[model samples]
Target chain A: MKVASGLLAFVLMFSSQAYARQTFEVDLQLEARVYTENALQSEQKDASLSLAVTPEWYRDWQGGAHSITVTPFARVDSADDERTHGDIRELHWQGVLGQWEILVGISRVFWGRTELLHLVDTINQDDALENLDGEDKLGQPMLRINYVADNGSSTRLFVLPYFRERAFPGEEGRLRPPLPVDDNDPLYQSGAEEKHVDWALRHQGWVGALDYGVAWFSGNQRDPKLVPGSVVPVMTPVGPRLQVQSLRPFYGLMDQFSVDAQYTAGDWLFKLEALWRDEFNSVATALNPAIERRDDYSAASLGFERTFYGVSGNASDIGVLAEYLWDERGDEGSGFQNDLFVGARWAANDVAGTALLAGVVVDLEEYSQFYSVEFSRRIGSASKLSVEARAFHDVPPEDRSFFLVRRDGYLQLEYNLYF
Target chain B: MNHPRRKINVLAAILLSLVAGTSLAQYDGLSAEDKGLAIAREADRRDLGWGDSSATMNMVLRNRQGDESVREMRNKALEVADDGDKSLIIFDEPRDVRGTALLTFSHRVGDDDQWLYLPALKRVKRIASSNKSGPFMGSEFAYEDISSQEVEKYTYRYLRDETLNGQDCFVIERDPVDEDSGYSRQIVWMDKAEYRVQKVEYYDRKDSHLKTLTFHDYQQYLNKHWRAQRLEMVNHQTMKSTTLTFADYTFANGFDDREFNQSGLARMR
Candidate 1:
């Protein structure tokens, strides 16, 4: 509640005092979902409804040399009590002074070119409470500087002062960890903890037909390790005592060197994202004390996308995408390692702006497939309707990751209104 | 059949002979194709140096059933030394689509380079030329149509001269040399006095009538260059049309080459 008020004040102040002006867009989304099975033994129903609202504002000033953008978002879910949330998605100021550019405040930065693997996009913490898709992110506080070279290349330096913890759903939420993640009991390897100042440097340029960006980041890991720490028996006033479980979050220091590039030639778009990361690679357990160590691993992804237009004698277009994911850890790697992803996008290009996307990620070792189908169309000039279906099939128990959410596959329908 | 009619015919025959004699003498040094090339070259020369220009435009699209929609944007163009102009368009309105900007580095040789910045994603995407024939922002104007019109892009042939809207105009048909071009040929009419394009008819790749565009309300800027205030393009097959109203024409804005590149797209607004 305090953060909400502070954001409102900031927006009102900026909008009122600026000599220039900005354009505003408001988007409201109403989502409904039906789970294939109950979240737990005590859940009454399998269907849920939710609402999400987003307002975006941006403007340029000082002869268009400077700009500021603000976007605030909030959501409320009817069935999933833990899904109700709000946050400042972005509030940043950017300005160009001669050959140097400066940016301050909260921002979100994307670096990878591939569709599935975002190896170098490590700026903001994912809002995992929303869904497994990593598109949504919470605001990150940082100060950055960019220097432009005469040869059309640029180098940017980032100084991140605050760390944002990745959000997780409650125990009652489906497709979640077996035990609740104790977000409030976060622990850190570094003494600075949440106040640790992490840093990153990136250089981007174009070479002939290909454009590439190389990035290096060293700081705390965005992913956390959940450890069962304390368990206590609570005394009840009347009948029986209840046993409660407590979990602690641990973040490790990590260093990542990554490169992402794209080559554009006519209708074909080829992209690659590769990374070498050093961190604690294994999950630590109370019984296995050797899990903590400085380990290095390598991973990469390669993909190509092609579009065919005027399909079926209409103005529609269809794009086919295929990518191969690789991880050096082999059997020790997560479910994403050694997987093949193939997808297709069908754009009707009609007045309704109808579109459909179907994709599947198949594990090479076990042949377990995570498939999804998404379709969307505009209801009018300001509103859009989207439907999505997801399924998981055929997985051995040793593929422990895929086996967890095997029954969490479901369908979702969403409507969005934009102003 | 009658004495008066014979006299009138004799007079008309003499006048026709005189007109034919003058036309033959006028083409003594050139063939029909050469004459067409010369006229196109002259038209290109006349539009050579306003140096740079910028304008705000409102585009209105209408469907076959009379449904209407609108888009607002601003365009800035810089004339390259020996190549086609570099142009950038910044969309400002309809709210949701605002802050979208497109930068194009048109060239007289090969293909034009283009980029688009999506505001919602804060990402700049390089546009491939394979879809250059696609409609721009769902308007009647295709992406290729908005690129700088270069002289080397087309081959010209002289058609004829006719009076359109009380102005004497030269009509010529030009065929695009680009293999991926959606159109087979285009016929353009230029006013003889100002060398301003007054109308154009586009032929699809199948050599079928596709669209017609008419320019109106031209005004001279800086007393040396003419800029059309209104342009209307109607698709013959779809029965849909789009009209663009241009305003706030400014020239010699001191925009450098640095401001027309892909890096400048995000700051256009």
Candidate 2:
């Protein structure tokens, strides 16, 4: 009902404008994956199919000097008698007045580097979404303002309040978790409420030929257990009873900060970033009292990339990145870990618009590796198609690998029409 | 003794004729009326050789800020039945604009019927009147300035003979008949040897100096065709200028009328 109302209001608002210039764009994707394990106890194999669609609209007024864009996106998944769907996407409007700009509504604001391999994109969404654990919350509503300085730098501030729902504690024991409420209980009169207030500041500067920035943000976290059936039993002394003793939400204030720098000179590029979080909050840690709360979590990574001209008139680019992650939650008292990855890409320079890309990623701490290969070719002036295949494996005892041994593949065909 | 005195007078007259013949190589300044007459006569000349020559021209437009942009265009044109009043221009390079055509029908006293084939639009559009005086692709050269120059299109007056860059040139002032023309009058400095324009100063309709064009690097083709390889125009009001470079010039390629038709534009590869 809310989605329908929002769509209707948007259409009416757009139709009322006298000289409105609007652009609509849509992107659709489908993927099927199969997972297998060697262990007898674990499920032999599982398959799932997913679909996602994103539609975006932009309206311009006053000769394109000022414009507003909204993207209402959705995703659906059905596998093994389980279904999930949601509508937590972008719905925002931006106004530009001279050198000042303001944005209001639910939107995804990307800051800092590592958009390709996101490690610092952890403001409003869950950690699972950042790690691509599953289809997670899409975006959050926020009010943001930006001011451009005379020296070509800009400062932005945001105020956001949003909500999300997660699996109840001990619900993994059941085939399907019970509904949050019975629909008639007085305590279940309203849905679970979680509110947050976050503030972040970022500054960008040029270090010779490289662009760099530093960002810092602090926010509040609260998740209340308002539903009676949300908590199930894991360990029962007598008969099975509700695992949750209290329905109060865990509340805390969390601060996250990071600094990053990148430079591209000639055929070589370098990137580096370091992040630190104080008093990291985790529901798993909160549920298990034996797991101590981590006071500080720090991670740092560095990457180097270089392009080589092959004798066969082909161009090849190779890059390597080394990263270290530390969390106090590790088993051996102090959490310390390191990972290294190296990748290479080759393309025929003489070809009009054709290239081949392949890479491998390795996690030293987990002793796991993933390899992928992709080929792309330009179809015409404004179209392109690509096919890719990837395989994940656990090293050391590769044959005995269980959850990490899988072949994942995807193919994408895209075309752009410009005016 | 009286006969000898008369012989001395004749001998002096002969010496004077010999000196006059030798010194006649130097250009003599023309009166205001004669200057206008010479420009009119040059415009009326039926054998400028443009109709038979395959030539490339590079035009540069410069703003007051010292920035320069260049545009190179090739022309293959031919006279129609020696009438000297009609001709067709065909462009062969710059793939997007290749096979595009332009036809000019010069008249004795009014605006010419100038038509251009737009490849993208696949149509022939008669240039609008308001755009006639505007810069051609934001260059220093206006569309009307590049069209065929006819005697009746402008009223000319010989200014004064002046030496520009050490070359003695004939300066002529011309005022366009079109009231909407951005320029009120233009002063052209023509070289004496080939009558090729060496420099031009444009005055806005308000009579304010708006721009100046300087032509250099003269290359003589086919012994009789003298063309400037570089022409730079600077807009004083806009502080902008452009430079043009010409190359790959061929003469008399037998360009046909069919190549300039609207249908030919769509068939361009």
Candidate 3:
């Protein structure tokens, strides 16, 4: 409550200042989803509707040398009660001082240069409830400083004070596991829990056609391990039985070093993202009684995109993308231990700005596959309409990662309005 | 004692040759192409030494049906010594693409380097520079149309002189040296007094008249550089048009490599 009042006062002060240049905007979206098959869980719905809004306020002073931005987001969902939520996406003040730049407050930062997976991007936790693409992120409270160089290089240091746990879909939501995740009962390896301080440093530079960055982060890991929670008695047709009703989120402490680079040559762009992670502690799993200690592992995602311009003598262009994903721990570490992704993007380059992207990720060892397609076009100057679909095929029940989502194929449509 | 007379004689010879060289530098004994190249060189030379500049632009696009849309942007440019030039353009309007910036580093002999900064994603993506012929923002202006036009990109031929807008002009035809260019040749009308381009007629790859560009509201900056405040481009094939109106043109802003770098694109306002 005090923080809210303080933010209000800060906004009022900026608004009252005559020298400040203020701007405000809002984005509203209406989304609907329809499933192809019946949900595995009884409480989940076949179709769902949602409405989301994001409003932003910006004030710039001293000729853009200093500025403040406030963006808040809220959503109401019809199917899942837990999916209906609100968050402060961004509330930050940025300033420039000689050769240095400073930013304070909550902000969202993105890193990495790959298309399929971002192995090096770990600054903010994923907003899992929103989408499965992993592009959406929650705002992180941080203090960042950047030192800019003349040769297209930058060194940035981040000091994050709080950790935001990733949110999961509720029991009534689709595209989730059979048992819902118990977000309320979370376990952490860090004694400080959510108050743990995280720090990251990254230096990025470019040489001719190559752009590269090396980053190091030490703190709590963003992705959590799912463990079966306490058993609860549930009434059956004949009698009552004890069953694990939910999955508890377990976060561990870790140190990670990552390297990302992109090379641009004519119409081809080559991208690579690799990371090495060292966990400080390990815990026991529900299925395995013995405590398992995790060893240090390496992961990498390499890809390339080649674009063909002026196709058929029109303004349209098409690009082909391919990427390979690998992890040292194989299936035990990540779902994409040994996977290959191939995709294509078509840009109409018309007045309405129509575009389409379709991709498929195939697990090399398990033979499981995930296919996705997305198409979007501008409705007018301030509105856009998009359609997205995803499906899973040829997944074995023993596959630890994709079996739960094998029957969760969905088609979604979204309309966005900006004002 | 005799060295003083010899020195005086040598000095006289040097001064006489300097006066004679100025008179010999005219178009009397030159070919049509050589004269055209000389004029282009003079125009490029006169526009130098500004160091850096910044401007705000309002681009209005209209289609055959008369539907219109406006795009607002800010641009900053730095002059390089031997290379083409560095420029940064930040979009402001259309709400959707607000805060998006494009950084360009052009060269005289090769493809330019371009990066696009997506504000929502906070990601800077290196784009394929092969889209030089595609329309910019769905407007009549292609990507190459707005890029820095270096003298070495075209081969010139001097045509007959004519009067455009009641000003004496030198007409010239230039063929693009780049094979990927959408146009085969362009006929330009540059005023004789200031060497400023007044009008241009673009010919498509098939040597057909494709578009016409006209400039208006000439303004003088730094008492030497001439800038056109309004530029109108009309596509003859599609009957579509785009008009660019520049305002608040500031020169010598002290901008360095920092503002034009790809890493700084996301931080641009």
Q: For this target, which candidate reaches the highest DockQ against the unseen true structure? A: 3
Q: For candidate 1, write residues B1-269 as lDDT tens digits.
A: 56998899879767985765223233347877787777788778878887999999998889999888777899999998789888989987554557789888788877777778887656777766567667776788877777788888888988998999999998999888787778899999998878889999999988999999999999998787898899999999999999999999989888776576556776667
Model 1 alpha-carbon miss at residue A394, Å: 2.2
lDDT per residue (tens digit) for residues A226-313 in model 2: 3232455676678776575333333345577877766655445566766786754334322353423445766665676555533232
Q: Candidate 2: where is the Cα deviation over 4 Å? A: A1-20, A34-45, A78-84, A114-116, A124-137, A163-193, A220-252, A280-294, A309-311, A314-336, A347-356, A374-385, A395-419, B1-269
Query: What ranking emerges by DockQ with the best candidate at the front?
Result: 3, 1, 2
lDDT of 2 by residue, B1-269 (tens): 36997899778767875865322222247656666766556634523655555556665544455544334455555554444355455553222234366755555554454546653223343322233564454456776666666666677888877898889877889888777566799998886545778998999867999888888898877665776777777778766667766667666665555433322222222
Question: For every candidate structure, what is the RMSD over all alpha carbons to the true structure, in angstroms?
Answer: 8.7, 20.9, 4.7
lDDT over C-alpha atoms for residue B164 of model 3: 93
lDDT (tens digit, per residue) of candidate 3 on B1-269: 56998999778767875865322235567788998888888789879887888999999989999999888899999999998999999998766778899999999878898999998778998887877888888788889889998999889989988999899998999988888788999999998878899999999888999899999999999988898999999999999999999999999777888767765687787
Evaluation by TM-score, superior candidate among 1 and 2:
1
Clashing pairs in 1: none
Tell me model 1's lDDT, rounded to 2 decimals.
0.80
Instruction: Give i-RMS (Å) per prediction.
Output: 2.4, 21.3, 1.4
DockQ each:
0.26, 0.02, 0.60
DockQ (model 1, Cα): 0.26
Model number with the top TM-score: 3
Put the candidates in TM-score order, highest first: 3, 1, 2
